[model samples]
Target: MRAAAATTFTVPAELSAAEPPEVRGVPRDGVRLLVARGHGPLRHTTFRNLPSALRRGDLVVVNTSDTEPAAVDGHRPDAPAADAPPVTLHVSGPAPDELFVVELRTPDGRRVLDGRAGESIRLPGGVVATLMAGHPDPRVSTGSRLWRARIAVAGGLRAWLAEVGRPIRYSYLRGDWPLDAYRTVFATPGPEFASAEMPSAARPFTPEVLAGLRRRGVGVAELVLHTGVSSLEAGEVPLPERYRVPTATADLVNATRAAGGRVVAVGTTVTRALETVADPGGLVRPGAGWTHLVLGPDRPARVVDGLVTGWHEPTASHLLLLEAVAGTALVGRAYAAAVDRGYLWHEFGDSCLLLPIRTVHRAE
Candidate 1:
């Protein structure tokens, strides 16, 4: 059985979903889902069938991080060319001492790798984003990207972002989608808390799915993990992001597991948060703050028994986390089947549910 962490395959450009399912004449939960379990034949179904797929006693955990308008146009004040393209500044998240983890993107959506320290980019409303040193450390080579920058606006930063910022867009996504299209049903609605990018694995969930889960007796819980920009260089560990796991949810997780009910995480974000506060012997504790945990073969999942997630890029570091949560062989087979079956990729794409053949829990 080949491990997914070591297995690599090409995802065709045609399979990348250019827009939301609604724009493509499909419902939010109408996207395809491929279910993978231990050495069994893969099951093909739509995302809305999720409640019927799992047992009644199983608990579904979701991330409550809201999507932020992180993208804003800026240009270097010292640029020599008069017709130079606008530099797209992506506000990643907060760093120490009021600094923010930011990235400069070219007009075509490529990372600006040649950014030097002390460079200032002019923003709308006379705001200025001054680039500081490389984020985390100067030694971490992120394709020579990401900086701790200071963006000063007229009012507060939050007020300025809501006024001028838009959702971060990628070259793969064709349309300039509105911020609402990037949000998940479970995202927290407060302006004080926001994810630089959507916790997109949960994007397929709709009100219909929620009602079905309730009818089927599946319990739901929530935590928050405000994500940073998700572009990761090969072999680059993901940067630290803010997260909060509540005591109520933690207690519920332990209770569910003790009764032999599966603890299913809705996305990699929730899995990371749950695993961050989990103790040895698979007990979950409530906690809040930044999490630096990176799940790989070295540290497999101890709490989550199943995962619902989106199809990831071939080189994405998130693939390793899937291997850690649901044995590598399961992930490999699922990805292989997804590619062969024309499953779409990215935030606007289809999804997968990884369950490495757990014992069945009888309905209560």
Candidate 2:
């Protein structure tokens, strides 16, 4: 299905957060939180009070996929001049037969790197990636910028990435940040690094916050969803990404719902993963596979009752998912409040919680 271009809004330049709160001399949980019910005036709070905002017996599902240093500098060996502009490879995810889905970005992250199919680009740390074809998904727009490429690294992809790749950064960020800063407190260390970008919604969570949630009887569970490169241009649907919803998470979610408890998704990644596996009866099944599921207002959610996420760009497809959860009117009110209150924007910015007024009353 084709989605119309999202409407735009003006975010003040000063509202763009250049660094994480820690780098800005604030504790992780000290970040601000904007709470919005399904229909009401938005309220402001601190991230540390997340537990108080959640109901007892509620299940908070999170994406434990760790961010990978997907951005690597590369050059075209076949270029005519030595002064050829350098290219950047933003690794999206693994493809079949040792190939990868990647987006070619300019060095400054402004535009796509133009190249023909069958051309080989030399990447740093002795890696070579050959552009094999355009994105395999037929539903993707003809103007979609992703490509399927075969990667050849001397010691393999992970080792090469460790030596040369950096976390994918957009034009808004000031400079490179350490891998530690990109990781969430609950990120799991696995053999394969999955996400092209950090699931930034959980970045404000800390051990203290987790303890508070536990003490408040709010159950937390994790699922894995290897997210693709975001920051898409206008009107672009996200490509398919891999996900694994374990039996434990599925059972917990179903149990919570059966007990008349809320199932809160910590990020859009979690919402996508859960909704992909949820049936109309609101039962989630154990599954492991790739999903191209896109959430919007037309698609009513089955399992997710609330969402905890960071502030998104005005035109982001994620805003559509937020609309699905909280409705368009509430989302508009919450966003207006957030912008007027000078809440920061981007990955390191403040967060918003979207729930129904009835659910908030139950939690309280």
lDDT of 1 by residue, 1-364 (tens): 1234665789999999999999999998999999887766899999999998888888999998899999999787665647555899999888988888998898789988878788888888889898877877866543457898887766688788999999998999987988899999997777554799999999999999999999999999999999999987777888898888999999999889888899999999999999999886788999999999989888899889999999998878898899898887788889999999999999999999998866544323
**Runs in model 2 lying further than 4 Å from the true structure:** 5-8, 78-81, 137-144, 357-364
Q: What TM-score does candidate 1 get on C-alpha atoms?
A: 0.95
lDDT comparing candidate 1 with the true structure: 0.88
Determine which window of 10 residues in candidate 2 has minimal summed lDDT: 355-364
| lDDT (Cα atoms) of all candidates against the true structure | 0.88, 0.83
lDDT of 2 by residue, 136-172 (tens): 6524533447877899776778778878889998877
Model 1: worst 10 consecutive residues (lDDT sum): 355-364
